[model samples]
Target: MSNAKRALQTEDLTKIEVFSDPQLSPDGNFYSYVSTKANDKDDYNSQLFVQSLNGDTPVQWTFGDVKNSNLRYSPDGKKAVFQSTRSGLPQLWLLPTEGGEARQLTTFKNGASNPTWSKDGKFIFFHASLDKDDDIQNQKEASKEERQKEQEDKKKQPLIVNRLKYKSDSSGFHDNKRVQLISLNLESNTFTQLTNNDADHGFQDVSPDGKQVLFAANLNENADYELSNDLFLLDLQSKEYKKLTDGNGGYHSASFSPSGDKVVSFGDEYEYAGATLTEIYVFDLASGERTCLSKSWDMQLGDLMIGDTRMGQSETGPVWSKDESSLFFIATDYGATGLYKVSLNKELTTLYKEDNHVFGFSYDQDKEAFVLGISSATNPCDFYYLKNDGTLTKLTKSNDAFLNEVAIAEPETLSVKAEDGKEIQGWLLKPYGFTEGKKYPFVLEIHGGPHAMYGQTFFFEMQLLAAKGYVVLYTNPRGSHGYGQEFVDACRSDYGGGDYKDLMTAVDYVLENYSFIDEDRLGVTGGSYGGFMTNWIVGHTNRFKAAVTQRSISNWLSFYGVSDIGFFFNKWEHGLNLLDDPAKLWEISPLRYAENVETPLLILHGELDFRCPVEQGEQLFITLKHLRKEVEFVRFPGANHELSRSGKPAMRQERLNHICRWFEEYL
Candidate 1:
């Protein structure tokens, strides 16, 4: 029997376990988190696990092959509440922390989520989708027969959407149901519908006194044409709300101060629309005064590190200190996400600024420490206890067993000077089990979000490619977050201009510096914005032997009309609308240059992707075929824009294999 470390394979994705959503108890004795792993059934199993700070082993609190997340402990720490799909749809479930079996709390038709306990822990506030005249107390899950009949009825009716934001990439086509806030009384066993308006209300927090709820919503009559998501404070007794924001931009992730006299929130004025950097603000309740705390900061707020292995949500906060003197938050900067603190006196301090990703965290006021979810190039994710003096203590080695079995690739960080003398950050993964003086095929990976960043995080796809004996290169070019605001917004209105040069320059730099890379046998791939760039790259240059574009945009003209976000995203990103400047859109469309494409391109798209839409790939494939160019199209059934990241486990494996096969055949 051989006992050697094995390279990570595509199928190993199912074996990788992900940890996130860490919540330290009020007393700081125990913490709860969600651990997710892909199963053999082509689905993911996410459950809650609790561990005490006194070195107790993590206890699995929830069971079954169901998704159980959003764990919140009661104020007394005797019981905990979480959202689970064990009983069909996702609804609130309560379990005693000391002992006993779990009990379902809400039976809403649409399923309740975003559960938060009130200060006294007597009620649970959450949000659910409801129609205008629907009953809030309609807490019965429809039977299988009724659900089937409703689906049939829905198929017979035509969707009449009057608003521009009628559909989303995550939720698909919009219906009459609008997300509304609801509260469940644990003692009385009663449910109360808080806000009954046409607009969707996002539950943020409940006041310390339990008399008010802070939420985000645009109650304006013309919200259909607006992009503002203002914050509002609602009085539980009066059922009336007071607008806290000026309604000029978007605001969210708000929370009350410990004293309950002020509110801290994260927002932006939409100065550059989607490219705006988030700023923190503090609102004085009595005087109605607002102060921008992060006005001088130029980076984006929250975790902007793009990775596929991350699952479940973590609180990105301007979490108030116990004494209400300062707040702590996470910010994206220079290819890394770090924990920072800002005092009320305008003093800023870096708590933990390592060259890694702090994906999620929870602060413990009692110990004045933090439980951080950290990930590096070699680690998927592990929870750690970080002190105020910059000390770190490992809390969980969730992936230690997998790490021991698999040989992971460690990315080497590289910074290249762009053609314009700007610095572009990137990482290179050498071929697994590489030998000296050997030339390896190179694959350049581009990231989507043209606004998101490629940082020091565990990416299974890149590792799989490295295992397949290909040198993988990924970069955070212009228009990627983590850099300053100017760098991130540089790609707007110049999709294939500066951003394209940045990528090409990075490739040139890598080829010139790395003697082990075979420049002649180069390949490129990306999704979403990266997908668009992949198409653009093939059309403009034939330097690569093979290319793979997933959920890409081939024609900007069609993309402006068919995409769920096409209507407004085009104007915000391209600085042109389909109605006024059709010529400019046509000039940027990759479909127009299909005749010039010499590289063998592979197009992968999700059939249900509304973000880029399947038509984009179809157009590219048809044009390449008409031009007698080498091209192949593969579509995943029931997949969306996130097919490469969080799509079906089986489909993700197939997509990965197709990518590897294409490069193998051409490169």
Candidate 2:
């Protein structure tokens, strides 16, 4: 392996291409997907591609440097509409399936994305942020002079906030704009706004008969404080809407049945807030009753956990069976994300179980087949056709050129009992050029979200660390998904408690079994929640020689007001609001124990990170520096919380350099 090709480097990320957003055509004869690759400028670019059902190389349907995504074929299957950034702002673009030059469709000033086709193909539905009082005419034909005036006006005006949530981690300051669901009449060349709410309305699926459109919206009075949304159906003719969900839980992934009489929903009752396991539900349109189909399945549905390497946007569809007897959806179980089949009568079946990640899939009802976007630890992701009998046929190799040039280390999956005897799952990646008996440095990699799981998905950061001759260890601790509801809710209100112990136990088990690990040369690093744990670990114990925390929380008290979700997330995870108990928030915070930290710590954060906020890192850095503890802080200027995963290429490479340098120097 060593002589065949070199190991992966930080810059190799540019060569790593990804394919996602698999969409089945109306005739079940073609499957469309999005492919992303680095442009000559080193910035990432995505394009749309389609392949025939008879196993052929996918035809690149769209071209140019700009990104083209959110693809959906028309009802006639002759044309496709997608979102692209070719117009400076992401707008709708139309392309012919037969092949031709793609043409621009919508030219909205705020941009249009996530395009969905109406059953009749007369109109296309999409989501876009529009000014509160602005309509279709106000956006498209706006003069360039007017836009220039608005930009100058913004420069001369003061920034204002009028809503409970004014900014988010994904998009910066949310002005007076609201993301609403709208329909574009292809024939009339006019736009119809279906939703007029202050909150965001995400379009899900349209009815088979094209009478209604299904969508999810958190229409509560205080949606910012509550983690709940209701499934609603909009009348296409009358332009009226009716709520389906009780607005108790955060229901999402709502899709109509083939008969259009019911909708299959994927979400939880918020039994454990954000950590609650996702369940499949069937809501009858006529009776207005919802049935929980996977109440007893005990596994989380869909991919909630995150990895450092995953690219491309994949569609989430709870596709109805041709006969409408069952619903198929994605399930994150253990180390694999696979397709799950659940019947209306509560019967459950593992449709496509594999030790890999099923990021997305498209069902071909007529052909009784599916095109799944699947990948393993060694593969990024590609389209695979799954026949009715459960056989998989590879469709694309977007990353083959890069993967073939670099050797990837497959980690050894291991299971061990935690401090409480509850089993924990983890993996250990040996350093490149590893020897049987040579001792080597080990780094315990913690994942963020404490709720997010680490499993079969490929992680670029972990592989890069392994390539640099550092054994990388990552595990799904107590609060991680893929496990049951109880296991996921274990870490709530007990942050840095059982979850921390489970991680420490995972490390102890690896060290004891893997005799080649140098116990004293141990190091730890994590981002977000993992960052919180790294901070907690250093403060509580000095076992590790060095630590790096990225976009982590240092003090919950201040975090409650700064982070984008800080206001409500604290209440959900810790069961304590700022007014309820400020002391407990600080008690669990790593900043409270800042004086106890002695490990040489390196802090990495994005200045624009409103999730954990750079302030969280600032407090920790200042506190440790004043205490005379060895520490350094590196902040990225225009980056966000997702810097490590999808930030600028240059910044990502520099981040990796800082991480390697800190670990190399201290450990």
Candidate 3:
């Protein structure tokens, strides 16, 4: 076998590292991405690397023993701004475009990050939590009698914030009101506050004209409503802010149109029932009217924000052409995500379509070309540019060295009639070097979001499993996105019912049609909702010999009390408040069916994961041990729910290793 094939066949999970966060330079002359390297002690050292569009060797931009991420080019493309923890805390730093000594932009008692430059490049905007005493120390000290009187008034008027879902992924619930938007003047080397209210104003996007800032803020009247976030426009000149949209629903991650005539943002229009469906809305500043863009296109916009990170959803907000008459965006309606162009007349045209994933588009008007980040089941993401005449050019080949040695598996799309007579679409990856009429063990991999879909991208964990001689089957099931609203919402309040049957039907079809799949030696695994389903599946049936659940929710009651999103999910998924129906929550929990599980199971969790805490894994492990069922538990320290996608490189490698080890032992 060739060396590339041999490297793909190797089972040593640590031999390879994953690359992500691909950022295109403003001028489209270069591309940058984060490369994570792991050491023998499982310590992850990440750095930034930049490569030119001419496909030259990538130049390492950041040299560090610490984590450096969020590499972004300045508006004029003269500097690169990024966040680094080399000083023990993540701080914003600026590096010269031509390469020079990096200068720290902000020095606060706490960390500062997410730096964005203004359109004219006169000022740099970022978010930070300055020490509270600094804001008050400037006030002239009055007499002791006056100070005592002011202190008494301060005690009477305490900071009050009313908002739901305040807790974020990395930052826990914060009531002290620390996050705010601040701007740094490049000429004077001074810092000034742009937003200083009690509410947390996350920096979303700056207007094309640099006169206004768009952000997501919770300035609602109700503190417990799980409504959508409203978009607000902060006028930089007037120093005044006004609400852009009203009612129950909210908006997030807005971007100005090329002409600055309209604003586009992504979020759901909430109903009394719950969040109806997420879509892209374009608000015209002149007419003061909002129009849903994705409504006519029959696609749901997921994670429409400006960033290089591959999380939440792969799709970004609309990318306008130079003339501003057409927009380009990524959609997965055609079975795979591809670059699509939408004209201002509401006409849609496909620019590129393939089974692989195409996302992150940056259009260059002068060159009349666009650069996009592309990947597939066997290919990791790399920068690619498309000419006006449809010619394609690869800008960087970051993974070619590693992929040359790996025996990668290609996914074959399959269509099967579900048990309910509805057509279901999925992909199957056969084991490497497969032969006809030979039965092999199979794994039914499930995706999280229950609302999220599995695309034709390179999944490291799935590829590793296929390399280990197992046919991997993954489908969008009912609750997955890419389909219409009805299909995505099909699993609401009906978990482990229709979605479970859909997966089982997929397994049945694979076993009957694919002669290479072993029926009796099957396995199941997933995380989050998928993890919940794995727990639910093992309890209901003994068809599988082994199962693994990662960041799962075993008990709904405990999850409701501990999870950061539990309060919102409990009502949306189950339509029951914790106080309204605690018993009902327990009834739907996977732990209630623990007595029926016969499959040897493995539980994986992250220590710092508040979304699905490690306690859930602990509960399941202890229960299975007491019941004398074969089970093992693994916990990753300092990791979050996004372990597979954006967690520490070393921990992510360990996660994949543990999963393969468990399956190799029993399957």
Question: Order of candidates by TM-score, top first?
Answer: 1, 2, 3
Strongest candidate by lDDT: 1
lDDT (10s digit) by residue, model 1, range 402-502: 99998888889999999888899999999888887999999999999988999988999899999898999999999999888999999999999999999
Q: Rank the candidates by lDDT, best first.
A: 1, 2, 3
- lDDT per residue (tens digit) for residues 566-632 in model 2: 8889988999889899888889999999989989999999999999999999999999999999999
True-structure lDDT of candidate 3 = 0.75
Q: Measure candidate 1: CA RMSD.
A: 1.6
Worst 10 residues of 2 by lDDT: 135-144
lDDT of 3 by residue, 278-382 (tens): 666778888899877566665655431111124322225576676777767666653567777777667778787777777566667667676667777777667
Q: What's the TM-score of each model vs. the native?
A: 0.98, 0.97, 0.88
TM-score of structure candidate 2: 0.97
Ten-residue stretch with the least lDDT total in model 3 = 304-313
Model 1 stretches with alpha carbons more than 4 Å out? 1-3
Count the clashes in each prediction.
0, 0, 10
Candidate 1 — what's its lDDT? 0.91
